[model samples]
Target: MLAAMNRHRADGKAGEPVLTHRFLCPASAVSNLRDRLRPQEPWRLGLIVDVELSDLPHVLDAVAHDTRLELETVELRLPGKDRPAHAVDAARAPLGSTDASTYLELAPASPAVPDTLAACADRGFGAKIRCGGTTAAAFPTAAQLAGFLLAAVGLAVPFKATAGLHHAVRYQDPVTGFKHHGFLNLLVAVCHAVEGADPKEVEAALLIDDGPTLAARARGVPDHTATRARQLFVAYGSCSTSEPVDDLAGLGLLESRLA
Candidate 1:
């Protein structure tokens, strides 16, 4: 993955690589992770780990030495239902001097999402949402996702999404027939949320399935609105790098050399 990113960066064809590497590892594996950390350019890195790991501080300390990788954020995996303030406090206890931002991963279906996002805003932490997974149950309904977006916007809390957003527009896989949310759909929804659109309107954006229509909506977003939206919806994870570029090119939103 790093090699492919480097090649793209060198070619300067597809634009700068906004690639990130997120991993799940134990504190004991810090040495192994250090050995594997080699990036040609500065790249954002995220670590998903248990909040109660014993050697987390040491692991973070070791990771901070790598100038090539920026420790963008550390995601805390809560063991069970806990108060948001308490969870953030516990996660911060282990970080002695490491300055990486912290975020609490919230399930989209959890009823406590709104309150948790509020706490994140109060405590200077970000939020993470799971957009999709292997099973159909992992994907949140349009209404559910809209609720999350609205709450995050209202609280002024930044967030990043992970999993299942491979294409630029919402699509149903022909092989599995599972519906997947599009990153572009999410971007347009963010624009709506930032502009104080109601939940129904935001949900409508998420439910858009037509590629051209969705692409037009994304393109129509005003530059200022798009900037504000991106400030709140910081980043998202995608499984395939080429898939998004291909989708945007196909939608006439980007230039591509692919035939």
Candidate 2:
């Protein structure tokens, strides 16, 4: 079963986010991140992939070296079928504070993805669901993807996503010719459909299918520090970039941002 959501796209540039074929990495690393990211001045509350600062002894280690850093989360690439168990081993590696403070990865592709999610739920693990909003696989419709999100919840997949989403508009990228994030719409449906909703009920939410409608389902749901569902939707608002900065600003999820 398709378990999570993710985002990965690549622009061939000297210092661009590393993504292509299928992967995401910091474009380049430097001690002066503030100057480079050119962050929106005020800064935002989110994890910026400091590959240099990451733990887990993987590719990220090349940048951080052996020095331990205080990080809230980091993405890990699971090797293979044994990755679930492998992750456990990494977490237990004891690189001191330098190791993974908290690890995340594309919720595995094996049965392990869903299984790991369920297990983590019982243990309250933080796992991000990696969805493909940029693929050509044609697995299912956007609505079906929403079903998978709710199903993950039913099975107890803790942290999840509708990644790759970047718009409130429903259209394909004219360039790469792939679908981009319509996250507000997707999660809106998932949250509504998941609240005491079933597969068939989820089906209705999917059918209703509008950003405001979906967001409305979440009305009065409450929020907090470690809550996954709320965080997923909140993140969705920022990452969507399907349209040109100005055009998308007025048309898509840009309207959904909170002050």
The most accurate candidate by TM-score is 1
Model 1 lowest lDDT segment of ten = 16-25
- Candidate 1's C-alpha runs over 4 A off are 1-30, 37-43, 50-52, 255-259
Question: For each candidate, what is the lDDT?
Answer: 0.77, 0.42
Question: Tens digits of per-residue lDDT for model 2 on 1-259?
Answer: 0111122212222222211112223324323332333233221112334433333245334435413222334444333456565554443343344433333444433446555555445543455545454466532455555555665656645443435545453446788776554544455555654465666665555445344554455454445312555543323223423343333344332343323
- At residue 245, candidate 1 shows an lDDT of 66
Model 1, span 1-259: residue lDDT tens = 3454454445354452443344334455556655655655454567766435666876787778777666767776543577866766665677676777776778888888888788788878889888888899999999999999999999999998878899888889998888999898998998999999999999999999999899889889999998999899988866566677677878877634433
Best by lDDT: 1
TM-score versus the correct structure, for each prediction: 0.85, 0.54
- RMSD for each of the candidates: 3.5, 9.2
